[model samples]
Target chain A: MIDTAVLKQKLGDLDEDGVQALLDEFAAGTPSAEETQQVVEACQQGMEIVGENFEAGTYFVGDLMYAAQILTAALEQLKPLMSAGGGQAAKGTVVLGTVAGDIHDIGKNIFKALLEAAGFSVIDIGIDQAPSAFVETAKTNGAEIVALSGVLTLSIASMKETIEALAAAGLRDKVKVMIGGNAVSAETCEFIGADYWSKNAAAAVKQGLTYVS
Target chain B: MSEEKLKIREDLLAGRVPKRVFMQLRFTLEAACGLAGVDLVKAHFDPKTKLQAYRKVCETFYSDSFPIENVRWPEVYAPLGAKNWVMSSTGAMQHPEIESMLIEDYDEYIEDAFGTIMKKILPRIYPKLDPALPGAPLSFAKAYQRQQATGGEEVGAQIALSEEFDYAPGFFVGLFCEAPFDFLSDQLRGFRNITLDVRRIPEKVEAAVNASLPLMQRQAIPRNPIPGFTVFIPLHLAPYLRPADFERFYRPTFDKLIREINKAGMAAFLFAEEDWTRYADALAALPENQVIQFENGDVQKIKEVVGGKQIIGGFFDPLITLTRSKEACIDEVKRLLDIGMPGGKFFFAFNRHVLDIASIDVSKLVAVLDYVHEHAVY
Candidate 1:
């Protein structure tokens, strides 16, 4: 049996091969749904170390990036096992997109990876989406949380428009809204009617984890 | 008076203490148009309207000089049918994360940078540049000539108008260049692909960046340097890398560009566009006097590390000007100046470019600029 603790450390250290080797070994042995879930939890906790180190200035975007990719691959190796065993149901669905008028997505993509690792089905609508598109996507996906990301100033206006669109659709009351990007802040979050905001990716995933927990 | 306004910060660039903190500012084309109440699409296409709008915005915004926001050359991008750089509905030109080069082609690219870009990348983004289509080259050549000529005429007219308004572009680099790693991610390998490549094919990424540096520097740095200007390099990659990765992949090339430009007696104005608190020591290690305009970081830490070694500018957040009340806006300006002004080489500028008038309070912006112009003295 692979020690999830050692796997966590290896992932945190950004040992891509080591992390994969451990995950592959666990998968090669017909792992149980609970075991798969436990390993997934370990990866999530490992990403926490990555995020903490990023905040502490020891790691950076590149490290977080590599860790995200590695964690994603690790999760993929375990997904089949989890499925055969009817793994834990996803926590909830989160609809994510870069808000209209802004196309910057580095932060958005990173958050998506971590969110998926943390076990949420995220439907990422691509960039330059209109409020109508966001409204339609959120409604069709039956999203529990809508995450809007934009780095430009005009995106704030677009964010407000999108929230108003959701409100107009009568879906605003049901789904919590989160805005992430440099353009979002406490003041703008309030102005835009979002439930939470994050400027950086690591903190964003942390916020997402808190939302469901 | 206009000439002095244009060269307001030339003294600081020349290694002398100035009477006041020189405020460095740039309003992206759409932002300037928004401030002037001009339609973006119209101004984007019409050179005459854009020049007028830029002048009006600069005057009203109380900038000491005309901003090098951008040069609108429709003839260049329109005919090329550039997929990455396109006009957005929100009144700005946004570059999509598109890569023309495939990851497997790194060896071929490293072998011949220019040939690969010209032969492989340009044609893919701009199908009009495909050699297989006969006369495509001729068609593009004609467009290039017309674009250059029109660009020169428009810029001349804009400068003349700014001078008439009594504030002209102080020092502006007409050419745009990129740091090596930035070029790799932005131009060839898309961000997602490059992020994976950095870890997967680490050696190949290093080799490609190293191979491309000389070509980029030679093309960017001038033989006869402009006294007050340099090739503008908007840094996009270094801030994302950790210090070790940055030093390994990005720093050498970044240092070379700065060193080559400075050796020719001109300073390279680098728009460092993210938190660079990690790379302070690395920047400090480089030859000093490069214009490093930061976007966000601890101002006091930046002042401590790269203070007088380089001409430090930017720390004030433009978001504050957009979101805060007038009193709060001025207070933030005061805070930035209190930390940045004591150092002889420091100048004031917002960390991010002024993107548009939609989010920003025009009154607060004016008040903030007026306060900086008056109170941020050495």
Candidate 2:
């Protein structure tokens, strides 16, 4: 039996030693389904704490990435156990990439980790993607959402072009589009015909989840 | 020097408003020429035609811009070629692939500088920058070759144009030296890697930044101080870190760099990007009279935090300048002037460069300057 409160606190503090102690105990074999769920829940709660710290300015983007890595490491350790216990399938498919002419992907990569932890299958089309690629990926994967990421104002044109391409491909109504990055805003989303835009990776994951269930 | 240009420096140093508001419109020659209907690629080789085109664009579009003694005319008129003229070793013409990871292992980078940077890092990341294998280090030779290959023609053309220019010509000062963390995040390690490394191996990150300090100082420090000039330091990776992280990983080196730059009688023109509202207090503690150009932070909060010490230059939004009506533009400028221009140490600039000339209503820009000159007087 693991004390989840202690686990949550340690994970939130990013105390690798303390968090690893709990994860090690669970991964040592013979943990109940309840225990595995609790461990996953603790990681989720830890991410919420990170998001709070980020909003309060105590944690930066790099810190959030660190927290995401910890969750990823913990998940990697527990993946077999979760699978053996018949865990939930991926809730939805997400098509993600950095739009054309804008090559920044740090934010997009972080979002990918968080969304994957939340049990979404992400198809990253890589950076500097053409608008048609997003449309084609969504059509093939039957993706629930499309995420276009860029870190330049110049890419706003690309985002607009991507949405137009989706509509031209006659696949606009089937999938939701969320555009995000350091350079994107709600106004930019509207101008580019994206369904939404998020301020940070946490919100992006949350928003991506909403489109699924 | 012209009386107007002299007044900009005097007012800034003395902590008084200049006779008229000073405006720094951030535009590169390519974008400027593009706006003015000149093909920069063709014009690059055509030196005589290029100078005439530059003058025509300047007279037509940028005549109202505040003329500083250290005018960046060389930068404006300089031909596009191999970017290596500033830092030959870095190999300017080649673009680093955004998709690939430059440094796969942090330990390799930590264990050896020249060995990893030259043999492993540069060769893999930018083959053009890595001139030779480990046994024969030939960066200086490469620099010479690169200069002869690309620099002579453009340098001569730009110098000739500068010598005859009416205003004080600003020369290329030097390349930027990032605080250790920024150098890692920017060139060697990606942002994701550095962010993880800060927690996983704190000592290695600190060692890397400390080791790179002298190298950055070598690149950044000017040999001779140009009068009334400012070295533009684009502040990246700082806003991404928390207050404590910035203090530990960034601030000390940045403060040292600022102190050294000031010792040489020049100022650091920091393009303060992103939302640095959290670190405003920490930033306020830097030396006074340095220009802080805000891009996204709340101008009022920044004004309250660091306005008295630094020469605050912004709050004018480029989107407003470009997309909004002329009346909307004037209102925004007047609003910023009212908030920022009370006790001097304020200049006019946009958060980002107005890339599309059609987006800017030059008359509206003139109106803002005119309005500030008339009403926002100290």
TM-score of only chain B in every candidate structure: 0.94, 0.77
What is the Cα-based lDDT of residue A57 in candidate 2? 66
- The residue-by-residue lDDT of candidate 1 on A143-202, one tens digit each, is 888999887877988899999999999999988898988767798887778888887678
Model 2: residues with Cα > 4 Å off, grouped in runs: A1-5, A30-38, A82-87, B1-3, B13-16, B28-30, B33-60, B63-121, B128-144, B147-172, B224-229, B321-323, B354-378
Give the per-residue Cα lDDT of candidate 2 at B30: 47
Question: Of the true interface contacts, what fraction does each candidate have?
Answer: 0.63, 0.29
Off by over 4 Å in 1: A30-38, B1-3, B72-75
TM-score of chain A of each: 0.91, 0.91
Task: Summarize candidate 1's per-residue lDDT along B138-159 as a digit string, tens digits.
Answer: 7698778878777786678666
For each candidate, the alpha-carbon lDDT, in order, equals 0.79, 0.67
